[model samples]
Target: MRRIAMVTLAAGVLITTFSLTTTPADAAVGFWRTVGLSGVDAFGFYDTQAAKVTLTFDLKDTKKDGYSAALRFTFTGTKKQKDDVRVVALTGDRLQDKWQTVTSTRLKHMYVQECRGTWKKSKFTIKKCGAWRRHY
Candidate 1:
């Protein structure tokens, strides 16, 4: 009886571990873009389960030209009604990788625009923007 109970416990633990690591069928989808310009890359995913958008930027400019990266998220509701724009920016060292998240719910259509900009007087002025791409 003791051996049977131990075996049963081990089986239970194995099943639980596998289940925890398994990804759900509705797992979030990811997107990535790489700009030919020196040191500009952005990528991330929208997690429907968490109702959040994650944006990551890997920026590096050898000249340290005050270059910054940003993500413009446009969310629309079920009726395709435009909601609002959420902008997340990353700035600091010339070579830096950072990510930011915005919690958005009830989104039917989601679009993201990756932008490269400069910092001027504690403000980020977008110099250029990639075409707005649909994420969801």
Candidate 2:
């Protein structure tokens, strides 16, 4: 009886450890649009039909440092449609890249990023501009 109980406890412990290791991470970043400026409208319009946005994630290494991930977005024109494509990139510590850690995790991929960057058009740069985020 003692041996059976010990084995059962061991199995339970192993199962718990395996479950924790297999659990996914959190990739819930938000997205938004950069509106109002000259190129803003263009980007917005392009956003309406279809546009390509690149996302780079800078994460921490397994040593609890920092790294990155990326994704491409193809927006289909419609009223509040959801984008289903996903991509990611990783850099920094090979033994422990946060990119992969969060890759399996899900994210909120579409929202408007607050303005700090600018919009660049032909011979012009729209200052005080913002970019959009992805909604997953």
Candidate 3:
């Protein structure tokens, strides 16, 4: 009985040691909202497991007249994070242009900041602004 107890204690110590020495894999998945024109808004999520991201920058406008107004999708982060960046943009003729998701093996971050702009044409000019969430 004493021998069995000793063996169990040793096994427990070994398991604890292994667990402490192991490092956890980073597998954080998060999403951000994009508010654009009536039909130009979108949302995206990213995985932070690998060093490279598969869907880094991608946007699509299913609205027949996505170009009727300007749209903007900005990436956001906490104040400590790097400067906010534009992940997707659409305007003028490009608004109606075909845009697809592109995989990038660059940039790795835990969190991202996001904002969207709606295109309310004024005198036939596309205008985008605001940091709010909207369903396209």
Task: Assess every candidate by TM-score.
Answer: 0.66, 0.25, 0.38
Off by over 4 Å in 1: 1-3, 22-38, 50-63
Output the TM-score of candidate 1: 0.66
RMSD in Å for all candidates: 3.6, 15.1, 9.6
Candidate that scores best on TM-score: 1
RMSD in Å for candidate 2, one decimal?
Answer: 15.1
List per-prediction Cα lDDT, in the order shown.
0.66, 0.34, 0.46
Q: Model 2 — TM-score against the truth?
A: 0.25
Screening candidate 1 with a backbone cut-off below 3 angstroms (N, C-alpha, C), the clashing residue pairs are none
Tens-place lDDT digits, model 2, residues 1-136: 9999999999999999998866244222333333343222112211111233334333321222222222234333345555454333233224333322222111223343322121233222212434455343
Better of 2 and 3 by lDDT: 3
Worst ten in a row by lDDT for model 3: 108-117
lDDT of 3 by residue, 13-116 (tens): 99999999764575455565554345554456655444544334345444654343233333333466563333444543344543345333334332322323
